[model samples]
Each structure stands twice: as structure tokens, then as C-alpha cells.
Target: MNINVERQKMADRLFLVAVEGEIDVYTAPVLKKELLPLTEISGTGVTLDLSRTVYIDSTALGVIIAALKSAARNRCRFSVVGMSPRVERLFTITGLMEILRREKIAEGDN
Candidate 1:
């Protein structure tokens, strides 16, 4: 599994976290540790990129929700992007799509 975090310490302070492979119970903690710090930085917005992720279990979802809550408390913007079809289905089934912002894939692109 590969987890990459990109933080822009500029006006608006954009933070992008990208994850590859499965994000299950074991991997969720690693993600949590990485995600939590984004909220600590002053003036930040977070974008979680799951474009390369193969799977995400309930635990992983919980961790993400927690981060969203933290972003709210800190008054920082938060959104998620690059969701695969399976992941998108899971989020839809779980009703998480209502709360999380997902970047739309352009037509004619995989």
C-alpha cells in the first residue's frame, strides 16, 4: 500500500492525501495519523484521493469521517476525490455520498 500526502502551506493551505491499495482496519490507523495532522495546520483544506485504492472497509470510512469532523471543528474545507466504481457504490449504499464531496470523472475517460 502506498499513501502519499501533499500539503500546500499557502493561502488556503490545500492538503491532498492520496492512498493506494486496500484501506482496511490495519491500514486505517496509518491514514488516520496522516490525516489528523492536516487539521492541525492553520488555514487548510483537505482532499482525500482514493483513485488508486482497491478497497476501503468500514473502519477506513470511520477514519475518514473523523477527519471530516476534525476539519469542521478547525473550520477547514474537506472533500474526497477519485472514487472507483466499487468504492462509489459502497459509499452510495452506505449513504455517505450525501455528506462527502466526490470529484466527478470526465466522460470518455476511464
Candidate 2:
């Protein structure tokens, strides 16, 4: 799995993390390590772009949910973006789309 991080500075910090490959039990920890910290900063906005992510398992989903909760606690803005069709379906089926505030972008656009 590959994770790329970008940060934008303004009145509030914006963190954009792009992921490629599968997010499973093995890779979830890596992603969690990279994302969890951003949730600690108040007014920090996090956008997790999964445009290239091929697959995601339950563990990864749990990690993402945890990140969202942390962001809420810290008053950060968290959003999930660019989910592939299959991943988007998974979120839809699990009723996580609304809770996660996920955004679906065209496959090639991101």
C-alpha cells in the first residue's frame, strides 16, 4: 500500500492523504498511524482520498471510523473522498457513507 500526505495551511490546517492499493488488517495500522495524529489538532481538516485504493477490509473501516470520532472530539473536520465504485458500494451497504461524510468522485478524475 502507498499513502501520500499533503498539507495546506490557512486559518486552519488542511490535511489531504491519498491512498493506493489495499487497506486490510496489515495495512490499516500504517494508515491509522498516518491519519490519527491529524485528528488531534483543533480546526484541522482532514480529507482522505482513496481514489486509487483497490480494496478495504473491516479493520481498515474501523480505523477510519475511529479517526472520524477522534476528529469530532478534537473539533476537526474529517472527510473521505474519491472512493472507487467498489469501495463506495461497501460504504453504502454498511451505511457508513453518511456517518463518514464520504465523497464519490469519478474514477479517473482524481
Candidate 3:
């Protein structure tokens, strides 16, 4: 799975997390473990970069949605970005795109 989390604090209010690897049942918990604590911190919006992720299952999606709800409960914003085509299709088909935040980043930049 080789999951790597690269965090960039965009400002006092925003933090971006670049995630790389497979986000499936085996690895989704790793993400949850890492991200759950962030929800406890006040007033920080997290942007998860999934550009390098090769796959995601329903369990992974559930974890993400759970994270979003956790963030909301703590008054923090949660977002997602850089989905691969297959991942995007999954989100589309599952109707998760409407609830999750997704963005496209330009090439050549982190």
C-alpha cells in the first residue's frame, strides 16, 4: 500500500494532505487513524489529495464520509482532491461526489 501523507499548512485555517497509495479496506484504517485526530483540533480545514491513490473500495469511501461527519461535529471543514478516473467513477456512481469535496490540481506542482 505505501501510503504517504504530506501535509502543507496553507494558512492558519487550511491544511492540505497529499495522500499516495491504495485506499482500500486494508489501508483505509491507516488513513482514519491519521485523520481522526485532526478533527479534534479546532478550526482547520483538511484537503485530502488522492491523486496517487490507485484504488478505493466502499469501506474507504465510508471512512472518508465518516471523517467528514467527524469534522463537521468538530466544526472543521473536510475536502478531497486529485481523484483518478476509476476512483472518480466510483464516487460518481455511488453519488458520493455530491457529498465529498473534490478538486483538480494543475500539473507540475504539489
What lDDT score belongs to each candidate, Candidate 1 first?
A: 0.74, 0.76, 0.74
Tell me the lDDT of model 3 at 86. Answer: 86
Scored by TM-score, the top model is 2
TM-score of model 1 vs. true structure: 0.80
How badly does each model clash, as a count of residue pairs? 0, 0, 0
Q: Model 3 reaches what TM-score against the true structure?
A: 0.80
- Model 2: weakest 10-residue lDDT segment is 101-110
Model 1 misses residue 65 by how many Å?
0.5
- Candidate 3 overall lDDT versus native: 0.74
Tens-place lDDT digits, model 1, residues 61-100: 8987787778778876777888898988888788777566
Top candidate on lDDT is 2
lDDT of 1: 0.74
List, residue by residue over 52-97, the lDDT tens digit for candidate 2: 7899999988988888889889998887878887998888788787
